[model samples]
Target: MNILILANQDLASNLALNLLLPSLQRHTLRVFLSSRVGKPGALPELKRLRFFEQSLCNEMLFPHLPEPGQRDAQYLSFSQFTPLLTSPVEIVNTINSDESLSRVSALKPDLILSIRYGGILKDPLLAIPKQGVINLHSGLLPDYRGVMATFWAMLNGEREIGTTCHFIEDDSIDTGGVISACRLTVHSERSYLWHVLQLYTGGCELLLDAVERIAYGEKPVARPQSTKGGYFSFPQAEDFTAFSQKGLKLVDEEEMLEFFKHYYY
Candidate 1:
């Protein structure tokens, strides 16, 4: 299977590629990474990813950090990173113009997997693949929809936080057909990174499962999502304080412990 991946350079997206790269060794897999320039936040996962683009100042890769020992580059926009980073097997760069689309079209991809690419897919782009495009969203669909679902899940004090792997459809957000879903506990004190990591892992597993099923010639089922539940971005600072005092009722200790170990240590 020829796989084409679209993602930004951040820990979550990079870690996802780390997992995805090994699994996709059996087939011809090419990755296209896009930079999210002008976006202010933690450095995107794309920075850590190595590709074949002209060396754009290694300093740009390691932006100023608030604290010593931490690399603090702002996040890369989907448009910025798509055309800069490319490798022999993976084309990493920012997609600045329509010409990039032609390059993608020429790949003749069997599957196009998107994680944190942060862009919407349109017709001809979606039609390029035989199996169509798939996204491993960080949030569960219907129950937790919209941007930063895992962060919202943590802020909301939800007992379960997970990932949703689904087929891309006509909607702008996560209103697509569910291929498979997985959930895990969210302990109290688990930071944004913790829940997102869980979501990443679960989403990856579900995606691999979907891929294998597709490889075996099974048409994966797609389920319509319920419209009753939906969510948005992470909680504000006040919201976090308020949740600590009133809104958030619970947290998971084991998960929090793991989160601290991985993130803090």
Candidate 2:
């Protein structure tokens, strides 16, 4: 099968790719990584969120990833893995634009997979693939929808967090029918970043399973979302305060470093 993957260019998304892409070697794959560039006049909170996210990626994640023309057996870096891909990855912000649509149409993808992709897929783009687009959302749907879902789940004092694999039936965010969902225990001692990173392991497995099922000429079952789950945007300052009050953190450097040691290296 020819698979086109739309994913975010971020630490967590990259980690997901690391887990997923290798297994997809059997299929023809094209990847487009969406940038996380902030919009003009973005809120300070959004800017701060982006800053911390980029800092973690720059300071810790990227350094461990392989450099151009370099491959280290000790660790699998984004640079190292990408070069192994049959097609060169495209980085684009204008995913739904005319040019992008043309480019994607030319590929003639049998299936489209989205993981933390920033852009919304319009009807034209959604119509391009034969099997249609499936997204691996970082949160379970109907209950948690939209950005920073794990944060919202934690802030709401949920003991478990989840990831959902669902069909992208339209332009709405995370409202698609569910193919599968996986849950993980929320460890109070772990950083929010840690939990987010951990989700991809199970998430990617679900995605891979979906792909395999599709390849075998089986349509993966999808259940429509029955309830209207609350949608969450980036947290406000007061929300962060509440998170802290609950003894949770956005990032824990030491814990992340230790995790990286075993997981990445």
Candidate 3:
């Protein structure tokens, strides 16, 4: 299977480390990345920065992930992997550009996988893939639609959060029928960042499973979604205050004890 991957900095590294590298063993994989340049943010600059700081702080709340030295960096963006990130990948600032479309046509991919990629897919590019373009979204279907989904899930004090892989029917965000999805247990004790990590780790497996099924001529049935859940954007300061007041934690007592035993003692 020839697969074309579309990703950006955040989830790009996640896809590469979890899915793309493994997929290369069997399929001919190529990547189209949106240069981490001027992507539009839903919030003001100050809010975006605040969210970023909060995200890093959230990471500290979790148990150490046992990444040795440079391996820790691999958990970051493409640059962390360096040469091995050296797949037959192309970087495109804009995915809908004529050049980008020409490149997509050139690859003649069997399937397209999108992960946190911002660029819109249109017309010929959308029509080119044999199996179809599949998006690995961070939120569960019709309920948790739109951007920063896992954050919203935890913010709402919901206990269940998960990943969704849907066949791209149109240009809408996460609206297509679900092909595959896996739910994770989200304890109220856990922070939104923890849920994000859950998606990063579990999401890829679901994607690979879906793609493998596609390879075996098992086209996933499209489960049309309802428009019940409203869309979301970036979080505001008030939202962050709520998140903090809820005492949302990324790691609980037992996990912290385990971290100490493993790393310190």
Q: Which candidate tops TM-score?
A: 2
Model 3, residue pairs in steric clash? 191-249
List ranges where model 3 is wrong by over 4 Å.
36-88, 249-265
lDDT tens digits by residue: candidate 3, 169-197: 78776788888788898877654544565
Ranking of all candidate structures by their lDDT, best first: 2, 3, 1
lDDT digits (tens) for residues 1-265 of candidate 1: 8788887655567557656665666767666756542233332222221221112212333242233235233333222333322343344554434676788788888888987775566666777889888998888788887666765676666788888898887636778888888898876655455567656776788888888888889968999888778756534556556655743432344643443333223
Predicted candidate 1, C-alpha RMSD: 8.4
TM-score of 2: 0.90
Clashes of 3: 1
- Give residue 229's lDDT in candidate 3 (0 to 100): 77
- Tens-digit lDDT track of model 2 for 155-261: 99899999999999999878889999999999999888889989999999999999999999999999999767888877777888888898888877686667666
Clashes of each: 31, 2, 1
* Top-lDDT structure, candidate number: 2
Report residue 63 deviation for candidate 2 (angstroms): 6.2
Instruction: Give lDDT per model, in order.
Output: 0.63, 0.82, 0.66
Prediction 1 global C-alpha lDDT: 0.63
